[model samples]
Target: MELYVRLNDSTDKDYAFQLPENATVNSHIKAIFSTSAARIKQRVALSDLMVIRPSIFHEYEPVEYYKSTHPGHLTEGGCLIFDYKADRKEYLEKLDYEKPLIDQLWPGQLIVPQWRMSKKYVAIYVAIMAAWLYTDLPDCISPTPGICITNQLSRMLIPILEKWGVQADLVNKLREEITPNYNSVAAQWAFFGLHVLKVLFTTFFFYIAMANPFSFNPIKMYKIRNVAITQKNEKIQALLKYLGWIGARRATYDDYQTNYYDYIIKKFGGVVQAYRAGAIKRAAAPGVPLGAGEGFQTPLEERFTGNTFKRIDEENPKFILSEEYFCELENNLKELLDEADGNIGRMNAEIRRFRRYGIYEPSEKLKHVVDVRKEIYIKDKEIAEAGKTADKKRD
Candidate 1:
């Protein structure tokens, strides 16, 4: 039987196996781990398979290793992480108690309150007011009076007020307060302070109005959040694919990773490709020369002597190869090519879809190159129907 494995890490590293009658998913994992290079201290049964991690168990718990193991931190390879183990029956019972609507209220999903928005706006406004207090007075008035000083000051003040949207009417209002004969330093400071207050109050009022819950519609913000979560859900689906849990439908990671394009492409895609290539070569052609450049001798020399093909005949020279054997191999190759093409077609379709609506804007594109492999998931109902139809035909 073949079991397809996908990882929460979004890797699809599946393999076919000749299992004992009672082999379990846990046992299959252990068998794989025993031969792997990963330094796994514990088996974290994430969903259905044991995986490597040294410390953290559940999402509720903080990933303590992050502080020490952060790439920029003091540590080299980072701290170890662990997976949580669940008593299956108990865990299932607990999950059953959760309400449907309750499940929907994930963190970062809720609409932030209007009061919080208003408070933030007010805090920033206050900080700006504090800065304005330190800046020099607008030079509309004179500490010492002269024609040259007044004209120089007027030139500077006019541009500043115009840029700030303070009109000539506002200047006239200020000018009328001063005596035509003389201007004092105190009066200039008072005018500057009044202008600062006017700007602050006007801006704050605009912010408060925009942030009020009644006036502010959450629909746009909610759509952004919804899109984010939808992308997360796609990642979860891809992870299921990586762990080898077959889905109701078959689509390439390119089809799903449009949501979490970076993680899927950089993190998961490489892992899945390595696993698939390793598994296929290991199981299918353990002793076969992969290719001419793969450290094997010249193909011409290998064909007659030191080659997998030659060795097979040496082990059983009495067996004779006929037309039937070559025909079968040819058919198998054709089937493989057909499957490869199908996989490419699906991926191309997904790419086109994403190009039209892919929102990985302001980020790098995901590199999820498509490839084909034997799909092991067939619907049980479909299988049963086919079996019954075959039996009827035989009868």
Candidate 2:
């Protein structure tokens, strides 16, 4: 059998070899070394050999490499991609995944323009991220977060960015933004005012960066983290995504599968309340609830607390056999879950505030939210203070 074994390296060269059709993967490794000693000067052990289908990128998921062979896994006359574990370990150490996608791509998979990864350009992106993160630092330092002006005056600045090699996503935002309260006369004025200021500042900075690139460059001025930062920062959006109600697949909190999990949890108050009542307990054995005469008797006693597993005592996962019980539990669960609805309504103002004003802190914006009470604390305090003032006036 002849197989084209391609090395996923900068060379992008494929090693061709002829061997028995039934040869094992170990033999293939030896063949690769024997075929080309020029490239792989070091011996690649069978344990270290990684084999995959032809891939354009590593996250094309080289993670899904074939370690063991079964029928239909590898085929005769097919091209196979291979990399040594040691070489890949060194290769991976040099990549900064937090950087933009193009910067992080493998050298063999994508060729990046040297200017794009240049110190000046990378620093500009880094500053954009930092400014977008710590938005409370001062407006004079960073562009206002969500105020993208779609007016013709702002449209002119978009080209300045495009000319200076700014990313497409940031540039497009200038053309497409709609101020939230366009219906309100005051909001419209305020929106345009910020838009004008942002446009002037952005256009001048970019033009200077283009003209006197060496002088305007941030890289020359300061020592920064090695990782290249990305723009319009996704952290704020991700925080919203985690807490949003109409659940889509949540990329932010992946452990729970989806944002629906957040809805399920927060709707029920907190962790303890979420699973305590009507959780459809899997019947302790799916589709098989303990019979009336089986497992334990009716009117079971409460079990011990604080332990991860219960040793003894009884709590029925479901009614032994009663529609009445399920109906009652469902009604109760609905009432129990509805308590958090007020929490949802109260968050609307603050969440809306966050979108318009940007976040005060990077950590604050991205912090994982367990309950809704945290953000609405300001409203709670205001109500309490009003109550106190009313009491004083009565006295």
Candidate 3:
């Protein structure tokens, strides 16, 4: 039986294996590392591998049963996905439970609220009030001033009347009842009366400010809590947009239009790319090879000469591959190839459906599908080349 298998790591290459019907999924995964010419075989462990059945709408299922069983039965065009068990576990563990439920359903990190006001605004307010008190107080307090100064000064003096228990209601009532002509001598008296009333109101405001009767805490005034939270939410939304999570639709209050899977997809991309990058970065480290510069032959060259190099500590208790292992690997590889083909077909169908409906806008889903198909093509070619190399080594 022929099978298809996709490695969970960077390169994400799919390999084809020829296997017997009695081989188990576990044995098959181990055989790929032991027999294949792929470089990933050196980095991944058989114990950490999981085999899953790829599907369209449903989450992939792990093929725990043997190939001979009803549930474990492998079909043509079926795809068996291979991934690192540790990665799945770690991803699940890293989710932010403390965030609101809605935020968790969306892409982007949760923004925690830390409320406070900027020192600049606080300083500006203080400076404005200080200028009024220092620059205008003397003119208002002078004994002989012009009509405008006297009116303003009396307005400023209203606080003393209020503090002395004069009812603002009675003062306002008297002012309204008594009218004076501006051209007459009584106009000065009328203006003084109006200032006294205004002073009383000003005094009330001063009292309120000093005593804080409404409990308007100055410290709290400095922090625009609501604005801070809103700004943080917008910042996260902007970041998600940059990462391709916003999709074709503009982000809105409606959750249905948003593509929340970008974070997970990007994460998978990172995992797929990390191994090769890390290996190259850590090439000088103890376990990895220094390559041609160190006068050392590659792992594949050493393997052909019947020489065994020290394996990474993670793969210490390596399982020896048998004929059954190879058979199972081959069967799984066939399944993975089938799944990939099925996905391409489904994507093509969806694209056709959209076109039939007269929708010409480029769909994010279509783009993703096209990319996947391209990757599948590359992986299929790689699998064929690796198989040929393996055959040559055997010959």
**Which digits, one per residue and each the tens of the lDDT, describe model 1 over residues 29-120?**
33332323232222322222232221111121111110010111000011001102111222111111122312211110111100113345
User: Looking at candidate 1, what is the lDDT of residue 277?
Assistant: 49
| Tens-digit lDDT track of model 3 for 71-133 | 110111111112222123222222232333222211111111111333564465457554443
Over the full model, what C-alpha lDDT does candidate 3 score relative to the true structure? Answer: 0.31
| TM-score for candidate 2, residues paired by index | 0.16
lDDT of 2 by residue, 1-395 (tens): 22222333212233333334344333333333232323334322211222221221112112211111100100010101122221232222232323332222211111111111244544665576444344322223325533332343565777788999998998776555533332355554564466556655754664333222222337633422232223343432332222121211111112212333444456567656766854223111111112222121222122122211121113522212122322332343344345447676644543332222212111211111101222233356689999999999999
What is the TM-score ranking, best to worst? 1, 2, 3
Instruction: Please give the range of 10 consecutive residues that has the lowest summed lDDT in model 2.
Output: 70-79
Error of 1 at 256 (Å): 42
What lDDT score belongs to each candidate, Candidate 1 first?
0.31, 0.31, 0.31
RMSD of each: 24.5, 25.6, 28.3
- Candidate 1 residues lying further than 4 Å off, grouped into runs, are 1-99, 102-124, 136-182, 210-395
User: Any runs in candidate 3 off by more than 4 Å, and if so which?
Assistant: 1-112, 138-395
